[model samples]
Target: MSKRHISLKDLANELKVSISTVSRALKNHPDISPELTLKIQKLAADWNYTPNPLAMGLLRQQTKMIGVIVPDIVTHFYASIISGIEEVAKQHGYYIVIASSNESLQKEIESVENLLKSRVEGFIVCLSQETNKYDHFEKLNSNEIPLVFFDRICESLDVPSVVVDGVEATKKITRHFYENGCKRIAYISGPEHLNISKNRKVGYLEGLKECGLKFDPQFLVTCNLSTKDATRATRQLLTNKILPDAIFGLNDTIAFAAMKEIKNQGLKIPDDIALVGFTDEFHSTVVEPSLTSVTHPTFKMGQEAANLFFKCIRNGKGFSEKIELKADLIIRESTLK
Candidate 1:
């Protein structure tokens, strides 16, 4: 047989006090005498009483639970971000519920609907690859529910967001390749609809201009950000009559695929074709030649997003805030001669 868990009602009955009195005493409310509070604390300790979050939230009209939605949870970047969010949430006596959209617009919409049904007090999100329309997020804003975005965000929407400067980060990487004596630089990009992709492309062009390298139309290739797609893009670039001396992928995942394909084509890294990628993923170090890439402040970005959501909640209204964090360039064997 199992012992029954103690509740406030049970405590009140044992102490011969009202349920409200027991609640106040347990919380150390000012109205409750110190002696009574101490008595309640001792009894609570003896019974191993733990206040139910759901019951307490009902009384306060707050769930004390923040909802987090990301493109993919399996990615280490997003996982680190979630860690940062959880750290700050625990400090504020709040918890979080997480959902992954798998880069699909429909899944993102469903996640939003389901989290709302759970009565989450706020939301932190990173938009999906196919999330161009802002209707679902707009609805959350219309209802005055506090929401914050991180990383891949919707620029058209008026909301608080935390992101790194994609343009500057990519520009630095492109310049690094030029300094390594790469006359021709090629960039493998993702879908045009993604803001990160657009910003990175712009940066690549600007970096070329700075290096006195002419932009070649044939050097730019777009793919779906999948490994297979990236491999195809790399093969296409390799087949060009004038092959690029260097290749840059929008992210490490694509870059890894590009590296594999480049090797398969009998090219030596840096000696034949220098390679660079963004978002310094964990696998970058374990590859045949360590990848040179841009390091995103993913954990800090998550903390800022959650902090922004809390700020909105305290203010009782949304005020647009755009917080941009800096990214670092990490040079590795892949880019070294």
Candidate 2:
């Protein structure tokens, strides 16, 4: 038979005292006699005793857990980010509970509730594409829960955040294409409501603005940018009264999709439409006319976010702190003149 736990009753019985007295003694209550305290300590040390963390948590009001959330688990970027978050979590002796929002507000809310039900100490979140309503998160904010937004944060939320200047990164690449003698440029942006996507659009406008080119909404296309979606968008772009001399994809995935479809449409890359994208992906090198893109330090972002999370836990109140990491431009064959 398994050995039974050494309970408060057992300790009290051994020391000829009540369970309440033994409890107070274990808690370092000053009223307990020093002689009795020493005796209880010695017995506890000898018995290989373990205090129940759950019971301790009941007194302190915490479960000592942290939660991290992202939009997609399959994306290499988020996976790298999560790896960084986990690395920092390990250093602080905190366990992380991760969930995927899958770009849906409903799923995001469900995940939040699930983590809260499990008594997570705090939240590190990436907003979902469908989340125009911030009420759910606002409720947590009002209750004074520690919430940090990473990557996809709502500017209005006023919460601690870690992010990059997506607008500036996109502007740099877009200007590079414009300077290379590309007259008509096409933009393939992500889902419309996403903050990252909006930032990229601002960059696109700024790029055009600096080039003294008129901003035509027709030049921009909003789509999921899958290969099939790119094929259709490519056809639509080509069927226009004017064809683009270059294309700016929000990320490498969109760039790859457009690259293949544009080539199939009988246009030589660079010679026809030079391509530039955001987020330097691994596949950029493997693809023909290797994509030039805005480089994001996903790993560092995650590591830093996790590091800050520990500070929040330690501080308890988790004062609002925002950390912005730098992004670099990776020039490659796709955007070379």
Candidate 3:
């Protein structure tokens, strides 16, 4: 017989013992006799018997595996978050399966479906830029699977989430520009569909009001959160009849692109146009005139999201939890006059 055909049932049949007895013997359970245990262990080793975690999970109705989906894994922000998730998961004796969506909604849906078929106990996800609908996620809720969203989340869902207060964070950054003597602040925002973008815009408006600055429709430009798009937006803003004294990018990548464009136009940092970005990525410090940015606790967000998932698992149902983490502004040469 092929080794591939070897199984617990095969061992039980050969030894003329019940399947449960064979299983218990293999595990060295106290109820199994020492002789039987030794015999089963030897036979299993001889047969090269391998346990199947999926089958075992099905039998117990609990898989010690988790599924994590992020927009992109190459970015340090997401990588840091995944590291935190893995750290906490190891302590809880759970394994994580990671997938990157590359900001594609189709890929994100496919990954979720594949992980579901693999029988992961729970999920931690950050919505893809193109994912405006929540149907795929709703299916998980209907199946009673525990889920937690972080960073980019679907506000329509009642699921637990771990995220920073985007509005407050942006408000602080905007206020910083005003304090630094910026007369008109321009904001390069992301796609309107994203909740983070909307919240940040609100904060930006509030900050302008707080600073007694008028809202200029021309100052707010939307992009697809790409470097090329941000560069173009910056060019458009700089060409405006009324020049902005400061500019804020929705995220670090966009900010970096904008900074490059500003320099390309022979503009001086802080002196001509103060700049700030969200998500204090690694490049924020390395770039010339080091980028001023909002520092997100990405690792802590991941840890908290995983903790919330386990909490939902223990509760045996989907319960609502909203965990708001802190994001602080880091001043640098880019925004300092």
TM-score list, all predictions? 0.81, 0.77, 0.82
RMSD of 1: 13.4
Per-residue C-alpha lDDT of model 2 across residues 62-135, encoded as one tens digit per residue: 56678787888887788888898888877777788999988789999888878776777778888876788887
Per-residue accuracy of model 3 over 36-131 as CA lDDT, tens digit each: 899998988776564542233452476688999999988899999998888899989999999999999999998987886777877899999899
lDDT of 1 by residue, 260-291 (tens): 99999999998999999888899999998999
Question: Model 2 TM-score?
Answer: 0.77
Looking at model 2, report the run of 10 residues with the lowest lDDT sum: 50-59
Candidate that scores best on lDDT: 3
Clashing pairs in model 1, backbone N/Cα/C closer than 3 A:
none
Angstrom error of the Cα, residue 275, model 3: value is: 0.5
* Predictions: Cα RMSD each: 13.4, 12.7, 11.4
Off by over 4 Å in 1: 1-60
Candidate 1: residue 37 Cα off by (Å): 54
List lDDT for all candidates, in order. 0.87, 0.78, 0.88
